[model samples]
Target: MRYDWTPLWRSTIGFDRLFDVLDEVQRTADETYPPYNIERVDENRFQISVALAGFSSYEVALTVEQNVLTLEGRKGEKDEKTFLHRGISTRSFKRQFTLADHVEVKGARFENGLLLIELQREIPEAMKPRRIAITGAGPGKVSQIEAKAA
Candidate 1:
């Protein structure tokens, strides 16, 4: 079945660039060569784990540029391998996870052939949603509540 996303653009303003970026990410994320998992740990915490079975710490490189997390793995030729019939493939793989603004990468670790990435939401004060307090017409004009707390 074919799907059209043009209708979504009608009500949106100043979000054309964001939709373009999403399109690119969807196009590039189709190749599931290396499997991954994304899970929410808590209210403001998240984790992303990627399976790097045959890759060692030295063979993989991780980087967080701006809000994009990139994982690059390239396997070098093994000098001591003496395999008669090699079945396990040691191919290069690269994966990218685009992060939202104020979503910070806390830490990353390798354990049990899985690379775990820890993330925490750091919502900025100005970007957070705020609610305006209402009052009686003669008693109080208005009040402002902390937007970040919400």
Candidate 2:
């Protein structure tokens, strides 16, 4: 399936980045390598686990840029050895995940041949919702402020 974003691009302003992200996702939608899982631990916490049976911590790299998390894995030099049947896939691969605003990577760890990434949404203090105060006067009274010309 395909989509036409020309109309959206012409109708919206300041959404170029969003359209670009959508295009990128569409381009990589068919790439399924190094199986992974995305789990929501809680309302503000998320975890991404990638299965890398023959990969080690030293062979993988994680980076985040422009709200996008990229995972790359590259195995070390191969040793000269004969294998009766090669099964484990230690191939190099790259995967990317787009995170929402305020979502930041907390940490990552490799255990039991699986790479786990931790993420948390930390909204800035100024961006959080605030309560507004309302003042009212009685039916017969009206509140007014006296101002002096400066």
Q: How accurate is candidate 1 locally (lDDT)?
A: 0.84
Error of 1 at 72 (Å): 0.3
| Candidate 2 lDDT, 1-150, residue by residue in tens | 667688998889999879888888788889999889999999999999999998888899999999999999999999598999999988999999988899999999988888999999999999999999887785899777999999
Superposing all C-alpha atoms, what RMSD in Å does each candidate have to the true structure? 9.5, 5.3
Model 1 residue 65 CA deviation in Å:
1.3
Q: What is the TM-score of each predicted model, taking all chains together?
A: 0.74, 0.77
Q: Ten-residue segment with the worst summed lDDT in candidate 2?
A: 1-10
Question: Number of backbone collisions per candidate, in order?
Answer: 0, 0
Q: What are the clashing pairs of model 1?
A: none
lDDT for model 2 comes to 0.91
Best by TM-score: 2
